[model samples]
Target: MLTSAWLDGLSLGDPIAADPLEGGYASRTFRVRTALGGSVVVKTQDNLPENLYALEADGLDALRAPGGFAVPEVLRVTPSYIVLSDLGTSEPSPTYREDAGRALALQHQQTADKFGYHVDNYLGTLPQRNPWTGDGHTFFAEHRLLRYLEEPNCHNQLPADDRRRLERIAGNLVNLVPVQPPSLLHGDLWHGNLLPAPNGGPAMIDPAVHYGWPEADLATLLIYGRLSDTFFDAYEEVHPPSPGWRARLPLLHLRELLCITAHWPDRAETVQEIHTILEQFD
Candidate 1:
């Protein structure tokens, strides 16, 4: 029976079980079951920003809006810990995956006045800058991509030729990518962050949320790809992307790769992935 004040606030009595939700190296996640009734999820981070869980709770609320998916409910948010309603461990059914894709497209329909968020937040451990901007291309190019260049690792690690190519890509963004309204985005919408809910359809977790071109979400969806074609088919039918989005994925993915390298320069797999994408620019 953990007796932290926040847990006491829940008044759910002692948890029957509280298992670590292990996977990523960044945060400690737990699945807590109460003897009286239902379960909840808890996550914590060390040396965290005071608003970290608060920001996450905000993003969860934002994503839970009428999208074709579910987000675990926010039970409570403390400086170090966030308690969420348990969503269970079920993998999405094929139909649920399709629904998830449709829901995501619908979610993207929700737009913003500019290309950023009201506040800065985190992507894993790396800081994300989200100052609002009117230009989508500049927003993606500068805040999403180029900003990582200033990081301690990213600055010197990215090669000069590739850096120039990034400059070229940024300069030619208007020509290369679609100009569109800033759609609400789950800024990091890869497979790892998505899950199936017990009650019904799919739900997403661990968002790096912002308001930006929806293609940014598409670009991220396939990064460590495992989603079926049905997912994309459903997504495109609901919200067809810019004509050459496939060609643009490698370009869009540069942001994440750079972010990963910026945060953990020693991750060889990520470093290799960065090189692979940069070769296209070279």
Candidate 2:
């Protein structure tokens, strides 16, 4: 249970109730009601070795900077907790694809000189293997995918044909260099992670913030399922993907699939989805 002292420090009045919010595999999220007749979302994680909630607060602030998108306003942050302005239980806009694509393009315009975040954060619940020393492409290929695939659980889960196909795709992906300028990325922009704001615009959460190929985010969006035709249409209107992005889509998705497989080996359905994606390249 959260103590009143913590609420006092957050400037929130006496609490009414603290109820759990569904979703998210990592932090424990709660919708807190205060005596001031207001509400906010508070996320807590007891097991994270690193200050992940603080990192998320920083990333959200960065994305909400002057020209950034309409991200959720972070109210407060502590080593053990993060409080954010709640958008309530409003359903995320089905137009998420359109709004999100445009919003992300706006975010990419806010760039820095380097190709990575100032501090590293987790991807979902797993420690993201970011390139602290090498270039983005080399780091993703050598350190991220190779190491993940070499794990016994990940390797054994792939059927023989699917495994060969993934190997080939990985080999081909390593050779193809990305020439595009690196842009700020949400890093994890799937449909589940994007929610609609009260103003009808899209709001993003659960970012695996980074600086890398902007197309990588778009590719991940396409991998799970199209965000909606409206989304693709809007995105293309702002910042169209370079030629051959469709072909590269599968390659990019392979990285995410491997990450999920490594983290949740027991999810048979997820494994099958990974196999289904590889089959598309045949």
The most accurate candidate by lDDT is 1
Structural RMSD, model 2: 3.0
Off by over 4 Å in 1: 1-6
Candidate 2 ranges beyond 4 A from true positions: 1-6, 90-97, 132-136, 150-152, 159-168, 174-178, 276-282
Best-fitting candidate, scored by TM-score: 1
lDDT of 1 by residue, 21-49 (tens): 76654668878878777778888877988
By summed lDDT, which 10 consecutive residues of candidate 1 come out lowest?
1-10
Q: Give the CA lDDT, 0 to 100, for residue 259 in model 1.
A: 84
All candidates' lDDT scores?
0.81, 0.72
* TM-score of predicted structure 2: 0.84
Candidate 2, residue 160: Cα displacement in angstroms equals: 7.2
